[model samples]
Target: MLRALRTAALGMSAQQTSVDNTANNLANANTTGFKRATVVFQDLLYQSVQRGGEGDQRPAAMQLGSGSAIVATQRTFLQGSLMQTGNSLDLAVNGEGFLQARRPDGSVVYTRDGAFTLDADGRIVTQSGLALEPDLEVPPETQEIQISSDGVVRVRLQNEPDALEIGRIEVAQFSNPAGLRSIGANLYEQTEASGEPQIGPPAEGGAGLLQQGFLETSNVDVVQEMVDLITAQRAYEMNSKMITTSEEMLQIANSMKR
Candidate 1:
């Protein structure tokens, strides 16, 4: 009964974590370039009761698992659907890769978001003012800007007959993208597990091509998340029932001793 109680308690705890992960996914269903996460669990160590005996023809050892635990929360990197905004500055990636941006402290971060705009200094930057890596600068008197599929930036100066090439956008990749650390505002930093970033132009080395006037929508599927939420709720209830039954069994045993 005691073992049953402990196992049931652990089960309930693990289910709670599942519920939390599902909730987060649903919450960010509409967030741009958002990726959902899933919970991973593992059974705890087993307790041996009896060893096998060859002479006695015993089949195998008797054992019982102590419990289960949430081992990790893994982020799913499946591509999200692209949305068309038709805005000149909006950008979207069509395949694998991330855009590199520099924070205020000069630390670099990678993101899937490409909704960019020009800052006060005519520098292309994210909404939070983080400048794009490689530092693309548009002329103050530019009338139109264009980004090629290979990430080449060009602009047409006011009253100019031809467009002039400005700079190229760099895309970064990782060996294990899920290992990157999330620091909010749809930004992620490289980690040891993720390996060093591979910087290059788009449409090269598995990096995605850039799409102007478009943005990537969150990958979360509301219907699937709802189903997961229901499953987790049912599992939690079952674990609670197991704990109750274990307690009742203990109570009955104590009454018999009277």
Candidate 2:
């Protein structure tokens, strides 16, 4: 009965973690460049109840698992739908890759959120003011800014008849993007599991092309998360019932001793 109680409690705890992950996915359903995460569970260690003797005809051993535990939360890196913003500075990756941005701490981080804006000095920056890598600064008297599908940046001066090329945007890819660490605000830091980032021009070397005037929407599926939430809730209830039954069995056992 004690073992049953412990196992059921662990089951409940695992279900709670699953529910929490699902709730986070649902909450970020509309967030820009957000990715949905799934909870991974692993069966706990098992203990042998009986061991067969040498030359015996019986099975090798009889084992019982302690319970289960939450192993890891994996983020899905599937490309999200692009939303047209027509804001000129807004950008979106058409396929696989992440835009590089320099954080306030001078460290480079990766992100899929392309809702960029010009900073005080006309440098392209993220909503949080992180300047885009290989920084491209716009001239104060520029009349128009144009970004090509291949990442070529051009701007026309206030009184110029032809546009002048300013710079090009670059993207980075990793061997295992899901292994990257999420530090919130839609930013991800590279980890050893993710391997080194492969920096290159957009649309080349398997990097995604840049789309101006658009942003990537969150990849979360509301219907799927709702189903997961229901499943987690049901599992939690079943574990609770198991714990209750185990307690009742213990109580009956105690009464018999009276």
Model 1, position 119, has a per-residue lDDT of 96
Best by lDDT: 2
lDDT tens digits, residue span 1-258, model 1: 999999999999999999999999999999889999989999999987777775576889888998899999888989899999998888888999999899889999989989999999999999888999989889899998899989999999998999999999989999999999999889999999999999999999998899999999999989999999999999999999999999999999999978
Q: Estimate each model's TM-score.
A: 0.96, 0.97
Local error of candidate 1 at residue 215 (angstroms) = 0.4
> Alpha carbon lDDT of residue 245, candidate 2?
100
Angstrom error at residue 151, model 1 = 0.2
Give residue 100's error in model 1 in angstroms: 0.5
* Predictions in order: lDDT: 0.92, 0.93
Worst 10 residues of 2 by lDDT: 50-59
Model 2 lDDT tens row, 1-258: 899999999999999999999999999999999999999999999997776664575657788889999999999988899999999999999999999999878899999999888989999999999999979999999999999998899999988999999999999999999899999988999999999999999999998899999999999989999999999999999999999999999999999978
Q: How much lDDT does candidate 2 score?
A: 0.93
Candidate 1 ranges with C-alpha deviation above 4 Å: 53-55
